[model samples]
Target: MATRYTADEIVERLRSEIKDRRPLFMPNCGMGLSGKLQEKGGSDLICVSPTSWWRLRGQGSLAAFLPFSDINELVFEMAREITATVDEVPLISLSGPHNPLLGHREHLKRLWEAGISGINPFISKIYDESFCEQISNIDMGWENEVEIVKVANEMNMFSFAYAFNPEEAEILTEAGADVIASHCGATRGGLKGAKTGLSLEEAAELSQEIFDAAKKVNEDVILFAHGGPIEGPKEVEYIFQHTNAHGFTGGSAAERIPIEESIYNVTKEYKNVPME
Candidate 1:
């Protein structure tokens, strides 16, 4: 099983990496093998979420945002499977706090008991302004995500909050999120990724804006970049070069694209062998 870490411990570990100028890498994993391999590859953190479950099953990452399965339950199931393979790396769950059937505190406690060390808000960052306003009207809004982060901190669990804009970044940082990741939209590149979104330069500028907003609330808050045009090593290097982002968070870029390419190539190579 993966080793569970306290919020402070996780922060200190990442801070040490930053002190040495090493970029942090947080990858989303749906399968045990993926998490195990990522741990070996020196992943700073592993995220188990409903979106990754959909991606591993050959569905688009957005499928998780639909009203299909219970999102939090799906994360727990994936976390259990992933923890069985990971050893020392910390596991963070991308979860929704608006489950009518489950309270957020209980959900967080269960995550901790299942060997997850952290939490990140999912589904909250994917909505449009209209939808966000509608959800906020019903009290099932971004405020719940902020409350989750606040509660996670009180419980000594790490919180990695995703913010789409500077305002959201400031709110999350004020809520005591240990890490604030500027989400640029759905990642682009894989078979199921977004084909069109912000350019790399635009994404970097947006990331810097979000980071600056977060730093205003807490200058020591760790900053990360995610999604949109930032796909692989080259694009992430561009983000690092252009912004003050401390690291990156990847979903499709980490698992789905690599799986698609590697499996397809290896299968093609085997099929190309001459027959008797």
Candidate 2:
């Protein structure tokens, strides 16, 4: 019922919110990254992943749903309760509605009004039986799947993804995908978004292709990569230095520890070994 808060404004105030940029710790539970952003020192912008968006939609739970189309008090509630306490920013990634046709505008609107950060809509597909790969399984090889792009452009939301094929890069750009995500590798980590396995070199090569393709179409778009077992220090370094991504995410890495300890483990030296 009230006006929404601005995501940009929140980003601007992030440093002040957390006092110091501590580890932007975002832990994912079954209920959509379960809003557990904590910090010891330094400021941080720990955000939540909208894994429940899909589940709620599938099960039809409005209460569990994020009012993404508009900003509601709940948005501020989440921001004030979580971010205010931890000194972090609340980013609601509307992941499942990656397909333009499936995106819930009303939900997105509410998020903005609540001062929740950007809407991260995406279109992801597994390498399936029809894997000849002439065109993408989802986009059908269109340069701008007019349907999805129109909504993102009209909303001015961030159109990010876990894995976007080179073929659909331009299509996504036109579709109003503000931030392109570099995610998903060969395996599924413990959770939904985490795609397991990819040596730093492999991740680097693939990420470069993504950046290069986007450049050919729209170089101005923000580049983001996420697929990783970001447990090792070298792995973190590799992700930051090699890929086009400005950030990296590791569900298993963060998921392995309890909250009380994870806050510290995030900075500690751990390794994610390949599955035997």
Candidate 3:
């Protein structure tokens, strides 16, 4: 089982990494084996989410955004497998706060008890303006997501938030999020990844804008870049060069793409071997 970490401990660990001038690498994992391998590969942190579960099932991460299943419940189920395999690296679970059946506080407590050290809002900040407005009209909106971060902060649990623009970043920072990841959109490059979104330059500009907004609220809050054009080492390096982002958060770029390429290549290599 993984060693549970206090929120402060997790923050200190990340701060120490930043102090060393090392870029934090947080990868989202969907399975026990993937989490174990990521830990062994020196991941700064491992994140589990319903999107990750879908990705591992050969579906796009967006599948989690659909109403086919309860995302909060999926996080718990994935955490069970991940916590059982990841022994040291801290785990962050991405969850939706709009589950009417599960109270946010109760859900957070359940995550803490399951050995997760932190929480991030998933299926929250990724929608379009019209969809967001509609969700807000129904009382299931961005504020609900912010409330989850607020609750996590008050509980002394690490709170990481994803923001698409400056306004959202400011709100989450004010809610006491320990880390603000500037989301560009769905990641691009993998088989199931987004084919069109922000360019590298656009992503960097947006990241800087969001980071600035978050810093205005709490300068101490750590910052990261995620999704869209920020897919791999080269793009990450570009982000680091162009903006003040402290690290990166990878969903598809971390697990699905690598797994797809590795398995496909190896199978092809085997098939290419000369037969007797």
| Residue 102 shift from truth in candidate 1, angstroms | 1.8
Model 2 C-alpha lDDT per residue in residues 17-66, reported as the tens digit of each score: 33453322333222223444333322123333333323223321122333
- Each model's lDDT: 0.91, 0.44, 0.89
- Write down the TM-score of every candidate: 0.98, 0.57, 0.97
At residue 182, give the lDDT of candidate 2.
Answer: 60
lDDT of 1 by residue, 1-276 (tens): 789999999999999999999999999998899999999999999999789899989899889999888888898888778999999999999999976567778989999999999898775658678988998889888889999999998999999999888999999999999999999999888688876569999999999999999999998999999999999999999999999999999999999999999999999999999998
Q: What is the lDDT of residue 220 in candidate 3?
A: 89
Candidate 1 TM-score, true structure as reference: 0.98
Q: Which residue ranges in model 3 land beyond 4 Å of their true spot?
A: none
Stretches of model 1 off by over 4 angstroms after superposition: none
User: Would you give me the overall lDDT of model 1?
Assistant: 0.91
